[model samples]
Target: MNRTFKVALAAGAATVALAACTNSSTDGTPTPATNGVASQTKSSSTTSGKPSNGDDLNISRFADKPCDLIKPDQLTALGNFRPGESSSAPLGPGCSWFGVDALKDTTFFVTLVTKGDNLESMAENAKSFPIFKRTTIAGREAYSADRTDGKASCSTAVSTSAKDAIFVQGRPPANGTGTADKSCQASEKVAAIVIGNLKG
Candidate 1:
């Protein structure tokens, strides 16, 4: 995805973030699943809905840019790339930089995905998670557009402590030009871990 897009948060903060994880395809069809997981069917379109507004939306936990949560061992670091700071080398696929402004204060967790990763794989390797749900974020009608094995390439917007936050997720196989079916699963895993680890 070479373009940048803005998404309006429920709190009315304007975020000029990345949009359409990848470029669009002619058919907009996802490449066949060669990863031994079942392919996902297209999801029906729906009108934007209301956010949970509390249970799943929290940002206070992450506002400070906790050094403790930056686990290099768990996530391979690609280093920071501030917008407009041009470089000669190509920023490889899946390379992203999370800034202080990118993370809302109440956000206790963040999740990233590359294509071909599945939800079951994450859940199996993760700490713990709750059952999946198809819900909205910041009043945008969204759904759990994942495959049966739980593979997708999408993001999550959650609210906690009466504040709004954005959790941008990336999943792989390139998916041609759309969100991966496993993205929903990745969101679930991320949310569960973040929620479970949060302390009052």
Candidate 2:
């Protein structure tokens, strides 16, 4: 079931040269690799907050190394995992992290929105998702959304600036279990970790 979901996502990734992402490898649990980007360590400030909406982080650099967004300690704390498994969608370059027990643990993603789709635009497409409502992570404004009810996959899209944003998505184990709240929580956790790594 998990492999099927990732394949579907990866299929979209192949539509364009830039869209290189999905959640995991379709073959099986992969040997953790970062596609040549340097390995990342967690920052001390994974907490969230922004004094003003204009105060956004410059996240464009991570497009080439999306896996660096995840703090190593925080990621490993979830389970024996590393953020890599690169693939992409029209949204942007993405790196995925799947728990060692792929079928039983959670799946995570961090995608840099290189395109023009930011939080404001996401609101325009709110009707497309069952849960596209406002929220905050790491002190920045965002929206938590899912096509379904987040029973499996959920994401938090954070506005980094007027021009770009970052998307952090999480999925429960492929066993077809997990509630909407739990899935969204996973997304929120990953988003905070990414925001903490951003400078400027």
Candidate 3:
């Protein structure tokens, strides 16, 4: 946790700008549900084989403890970043993790946007989000964007509802140990897990 790493996203003539972000060792197990919400015993209700709806993933229940949104086992599966470290970003309240040891360059986050714009609106505006592309994650509507300001960031904005988006972001170490696409791949995996564990 004392070591420093780098992720290269050298800035230049670009149309995008990824927000600043900034995990890997939890040997116990997946964190249990807080706020008295029961953990899901069945497969992801939010991830059924079909598409997602506005009510698919509601994180309001986790507003007090955003880190609990992800289970540690799932985090372990995704390069095991350090345990959920809650943080604040331009999007909203969120948690971040950085891989330790050999998992360097592996960094990811889950941000809850209570008042942020949805993917469609963000794309349509083109002022705040200039490079948003429609996509899907675990049957949920999503959008992907990379940091154009150079900093190496890959983000998948999941539409919890047509009006709300959950920001799942990824970035390599600043030491150039990773790339935006690869980080994004990791972020997508995390997003899928989040969706899979969402309560019905």
Best by lDDT: 2
**Preferred candidate (lDDT higher): 1 or 3:** 3
Q: Candidate 1, which segments miss by more than 4 Å at Cα?
A: 1-58, 66-133, 136-152, 173-179
Give the per-residue lDDT digits (tens) of candidate 1, residues 1-200: 22221122211111111211221345643222222211221211211123344455333344344322234532333222222111111101221333223332111124222222222222221212222344654343233332223332444433333212233333332233333444554454444444444432
lDDT score of residue 19 within candidate 2: 21
Which segments of model 2 are wrong by more than 4 Å? 1-54
Q: Whole-model lDDT for model 3 versus the true structure?
A: 0.52
Encode model 3's per-residue lDDT on 34-152: one tens digit a residue.
11111111122222223344355677777678788788777766664666677554445777666564235466667776544454443332223333456788877776665253136
TM-score of each: 0.33, 0.71, 0.64
What would the per-residue lDDT of candidate 2 be over residues 85-191, giving only the tens digit for each residue?
A: 87665667878776655677786767787654555554444434666678888777788876666787777777787666787767678675798888888888888
lDDT of each: 0.30, 0.62, 0.52
Error of 1 at 2 (Å): 16
Clashing pairs in 2: 19-88, 20-87, 20-88, 21-87, 21-88, 48-138, 48-139, 49-138, 49-139
Candidates ranked by TM-score: 2, 3, 1
TM-score of 1: 0.33
